[model samples]
Target: MKDGWIVNRAGLINFWYYDDEVFEFMDGRLLIRGANGSGKSVTMQSFIPLLLDGNKSPERLDPFGSRARKLEDYLLGEEALSQTNERTGYIYMEFKKQNTKNYLTIGMGLRARRGQPMDSWGFTLLDGRRVG
Candidate 1:
């Protein structure tokens, strides 16, 4: 039997260009290819450190490690796309046992209001449990 867990998928809901998107992986590998302004970076930045530890520091929101973006910017939308004063979103990654049906899932949920600081929560589920 294979000995360890492998990533099975990543999901985004109401985040960036995705109202709901699910990315499936093959043998723990996923290739995210898209055109410019197509949200490839946004998708990566939204997951990595955020899903890894639920940290929302501005620097973590950018792939360049610069504080050029904010979690609120994604939730409340940018000035031009600001259609709602408040919003919530979720990001998650799921892993499957190397040779079994068992699985583990981890995710972060973020909330933002136009004039309020952002808030977030992180969670983990085992035995294939999930939320989305």
Candidate 2:
């Protein structure tokens, strides 16, 4: 399969509690090492807001369950319902099969304001050709 960087993320929010953020991963394997509560899980949690319209707390039994609910509510507020911040960077993902040397790319971006409809952009490619 074609090998290349699949996902790119920048200006992440809850991921690390950092003011500004950038992260990229290829092939869907992420290697994170840091001190406890150093924001590793927080950084990962940032995506929950983006993926689920708003963030949903993980089941109470899950490690990050408490924060999940809090974050979800934060994202789904009445004025700013979008999970991702308008100023945050974008995320891109690509995939490849085990034996078939083929690749696909997916890209997405989000923009929202306190009183505006959230905006999104997405594109997909197969073998570097737009098929969907």
Query: Superposing every Cα of model 2 onto the true structure, what RMSD results?
Result: 7.3
Residue 86, model 1: Cα distance from true site in angstroms: 0.8
In the range 22-70, model 2's lDDT, one tens digit per residue, is 5555454577799996767655645534443432334431345553343
Q: Using alpha carbons, what is the TM-score of model 1?
A: 0.89
Give each prediction's root-mean-square deviation over alpha carbons. 1.8, 7.3
Kindly list the per-residue Cα lDDT of model 1 for residues 48-98, writing each as its tens digit: 878876678888888778887788888767867678788898889998988
**Candidate 1 lDDT trough over 10 residues, lowest sum:** 123-132
Return the top candidate by lDDT: 1
Estimate the lDDT of model 1: 0.83
Residue pairs in clash, model 1: none
